[model samples]
Target: MTSTVLTGISELWTLDPALDDPARPGDVADAQVLRYAAVVIEEGRIAWTGPAADAPAADAREDLGGRAVLPGWVDSHSHLVFDGDRAAEFEARMAGRSYSAGGIAVTTDATRAAADARLRDLVRDRIAEAVAGGTTCLETKTGYGLTVADELRAAQLLDALIAEGALDEATFLGAHLVPREFDGEDGRPGAAQYVDLVAGEMLAAVAEHVRWIDVFCEDGAFDPEQSAQVLRAGAAAGLGLRVHGHQLGRSGGVALAAALGAASVDHVNHLAAEDVEALAATAARPTAPGDRPGLLAVDAGPTVATVLPACDLSTRAPLAPARELLDAGAAVAIASNCNPGTSYTSAMSFCVTTAVLQMHLSLGEAVRAATRGGALALRRGDVGHLGVGARADLHVLDAPAAIHLAYRPGMPMTHRVWRHGQEQPLAPVPPTPTP
Candidate 1:
């Protein structure tokens, strides 16, 4: 196959533990930064990567002008399958009105009322926008469409994104919230009847088009029992599990996620000591084929604690305990959680910067969490790292070092991005909301 040699790389972070690095000794410390490096891409895969001096010549050559390259950001959690904007709710939260589950209904109503063509255009733009911001692998869910028909349509829409090579995973989040019709006599929503639908026909309808199932297991959503039922049903239907847990309060969501063996539990801002311990154990547990339903394996990976810094900031909630999870030996992942209601930004660079400056993660660790950690969270090993045989998903930075992502916050850090070896441009982005 023909190949192209990318030369003049100042720093290339492979995020692979086995790669050589001279800066730090430990596996975590050595982010596999190769200075003065060159990489060969052939047939949409990394054919060779090493120091420039020992690099084998390729059929074609391209100079990078001394840039930094890392694995493209793998955004493993988001809610990008809806219409309408939540700018008013965001403004209210900024004014100290506090975020609540009630706001999801507004988006749900708008999504259901929107024409299919309008929603598809919106999803397409949002995904292209994320890729321009250096996200190579996106995992978005269908939650706003609570009914069976709408949920299936949303799933079909996500399949279209997958065909375009923009999205890597699709999740059915029919249990994201209860519609107004399901409000209990006590006036609470998503309490009982809604959970039944999510665990039954809704789950079956969306399973064919999706690879994962998720529940909003918190106050004003499904309780522990309801959440567990949905998880077990999804697994029975042969779909992997994800959870929107612990964002609102310490409602036993973390513990439930561990017990049920979710692929990754997103929004971990309320983890207690026991929750941490349970998560560590889940991360270390081994799974083989034909295991019990709770421990069914996804790419033979552990449960991951996914933190959404942007979502926390937008909702004014506490940042997830990423440091503590890392210290406890639990795998941690950082995601954009890009949604209209909670997080409007699809900028993974912003998320990584906040992780280093505010969440107390090292630059290496933060990048790892955003890339490899995210792939592990989804239990897909082929996309996150730049190992010799891995996919050619590359993110080239305009700066010389990865630290500049955190150092120069709020700037366009990406120089060029390649997803499956297609060079993505930096313009024709999503339109800004008009005032």
Candidate 2:
């Protein structure tokens, strides 16, 4: 196995707590930054990291000429497998008209009508965009296709992406909406019958292909009972759990997610006191020494409280209580819920910046949440941080410091990206937004 030492890095942000920190000792920080740093990549994993003066000799060496490097962003949530334009809705929202914004049903209509090859191309292109912008691992769901066929097709495509070595996680969201055909008396629709279909046929068909199951437990989506039915059914089908809760309003979404041992509860913009406690408890875990050797990983501890800042800002919804969750010891992840309807951007850098500048998080806190926290949200290990045994997933920034991600706003900050020791060439993907 060949080893390469990347030396002469002006700044290196290592989220690994075990690394020594002469830069800020006794300062009580969540992360470590090394000056004149060097990292050795061997056999597709980080073999060594330290000051360049003491770096062990490697099979090869490359001087970075004083650039900054950090763990590659891990986007745990997205909606990259759908198509169609939602521009008129975005335009209306900007013009002071409150938007009920066409939800899943609208996207389902478009996605179901799209060709399989086209959908495959769209998914690949979106992943390419995320990678180009520094994301190494991302997870996308299958809610745009509600019917058994549509849902299965979406899952199959995602599975193909996973097999082809792009997307790392696929989620089954068949219970995302109750579909127009399920509408019934009292103006609420036959949600119960729709739940039955999702729990039975839909769950059985997509379970084998998906790694996790998610339900939109918002007020206008699935109620508490229906959400529970879907989650229970998904668990029975051997899938992990995640929930889209309370983006619209407080509808007991967080409580339901915590009660069922969900891996993550996302879009927590309207949490109550109890909801906060539940989330804090869900993210709490005892320290472990398994795959990580001496770091913290859980068999199943507290739920990961994921906050989608871009989606919140896009929908004009209140930002999630990020500071509150972090203060209470909850593991919170920041993700670019990059979907067409709510958050139309897949720039994890933008999401991290919003978290630090608007949401009142420290730069280190924001970066880790966008990276390591995201990995935890997906129940994945060894890919988020630059731990010794972790995969060599890193992003070298064009700037000299990590704060430049926020300070520079929209500059092309990513200089280079390496995934599993493979350097990815920069490719310009086409504009993703609708006209």
C-alpha lDDT score of every prediction, in listed order: 0.85, 0.83
Look at candidate 1 and tell me the lDDT of residue 159. 86
Candidate 1 segments exceeding 4 Å error: 20-31, 185-190, 287-300, 430-435
Candidate 2 residue lDDT tens string, 1-435: 899999989888777756534353212244467788999999888888888999999999998888999999999999887989677777777787554524667888989999898888888888888999999988999999888999999999999888887888899998888888786666755879889999999889998898889999876788888999999988888777889988888877789888888878899999887788888776545434434332233236568889998988888888998988888778789899998888898899998889988998888779988987887787766777787877799999998888999999888999899998889877888765542
Model 1: lDDT of residue 81: 89
- TM-scores of all candidate predictions against the true structure: 0.93, 0.92
Extract clashing residue pairs from model 2: 184-189, 282-302, 282-303, 283-302
Q: Give the TM-score of candidate 1.
A: 0.93
Instruction: Assess candidate 2 and give its lDDT.
Output: 0.83
| Collision pairs in model 1 | none
Quality of model 1 by C-alpha lDDT: 0.85
Per-candidate clashes, comma-separated? 0, 4
